[model samples]
Target: MKKKITLSILISEILNLISAPLAHAASLSDVYLPGKALGGSGATIGGFVTPLIQNLALLMTGLTFIILLLSGFKYITSHGNPKGTQQAKDMLTYSLVGLVLSIAAYWITKLAFVAAGLDFLF
Candidate 1:
């Protein structure tokens, strides 16, 4: 029951983070204007795709952060058990690696778009 409650809280937190950007919008039209949201001129391929890529990167980063937190929790709760401790350490390492890779990927993608002359969208 405690685990269930913790999981639910984590899920709700994630959902809230994802939706926080939209909460400030006054209308559906504001939410629909991705280009404007990103400070671009208007609707274009870059306007659409850039935000999509950014959002995906943000989501991945958030997931990695959550994984790191869980791994720490596991490590603390392992009580010196070698197997459980190892698993937690592995999870922590993997989450850090994933976070780095996702950030690099996001930068690489942005650079690619800029190279392709889509600087205005980014």
Candidate 2:
């Protein structure tokens, strides 16, 4: 009972933290600079692309975590087989590499946008 209550409280706290940013999120009108036209690429494209890249990075990171879990499970169930153990090790390495690449992609997207003179994130 104690563990359940503690776990529930922790989960709720995490949810609140995750949702806090979204709760104070900018409205569509806020996406545009005061003098910029709504339909212009500066507002529309930047707003769309920044979030899309961020979300994609987040998704890839989550999938990498799932892959890590699968790799661990495979290792545990490998039953001393050399090939299976090697496969699990390879999976773990590949998943870590993928996670790193995903994070890099997110940063690269930001840099590319800034280099293109969009500077939308700021």
Candidate 3:
């Protein structure tokens, strides 16, 4: 009974903490408005999505690089263990593939944005 009550109280506190943020949540306009947060006064889908896509691409690239490094380390440390070496090789291959895909995706998005005359967004 005591444990249950404590768990319930903890859950309630968590709910309260989460609700505080929801109560003050920004509206869609506020969120989608380009440069509003940056003290600029323009709102375009390109403006909103370009940065998001770029940032996502950058993040993915960084993560892929880190994965590649870890996988290389694993490969070097495998010490003739076939399974470990294979796993590390797989990781390296997958990370390289992901990095390539992300770069291609970023370029495609950039081309689309340019074709749409939103090149200025970049």
Candidate 4:
């Protein structure tokens, strides 16, 4: 029963992640970093900057999730052995570092986007 419930939750989370990008994709093709967004057709420097920032955000988020999965695996394998426990602790610590670094990266990027006068993410 417990295994079934856990499996269901895991499946739901996977489905949600798969569906999110489709839901949030922007429709506009001629973006111009917010300030100069009125210009049409030609690719400007500001135009590339927006896609770069958006992709970086997705990368950071994915990296954080990967770290979390590693930590979860470590925890699961740490059952009755001292060596396993230490390994798990190490993985968890590293995971925490990755998490903090990713959050800092996200905040800094968000600040940069605002400074660049582009649309902000929450």
Candidate 2 Cα outliers beyond 4 Å, as residue runs: 1-42
TM-score of each: 0.63, 0.63, 0.63, 0.49
| TM-score winner between candidates 1 and 4 | 1
Candidate 3 lDDT over 32-110, as tens digits, reads: 5655654668578776797899789889988998999999999999998999999999999999999999999888888
Task: State the lDDT at 22 in candidate 4.
Answer: 54
Q: Looking at model 2, which ten-residue stretch has the lowest summed lDDT?
A: 34-43
lDDT of 2 by residue, 1-122 (tens): 99999999999999999988864675666555632433334445787677778788889988998999999999999999999999999999999999998888788877888898875564
Worst 10 residues of 1 by lDDT: 25-34
Query: Candidate 4 lDDT, tens digit per residue, 1-122?
Result: 99999999999999999878854553464233332333444655545766776687678778767877886787787786788877777877876787688678777877887898766644
Which is the winner by lDDT between candidate 3 and candidate 4?
Answer: 3
lDDT of each: 0.85, 0.82, 0.85, 0.70
Clashing pairs in 1: none
The clash count for each model shown is 0, 0, 0, 0
- Candidate 1 deviates by what RMSD? 18.9
Better of 2 and 3 by lDDT: 3
- Report the Cα lDDT for residue 98, model 3: 93
Give the Cα-based TM-score of candidate 3 against the true structure.
0.63
Error of 3 at 57 (Å): 1.3
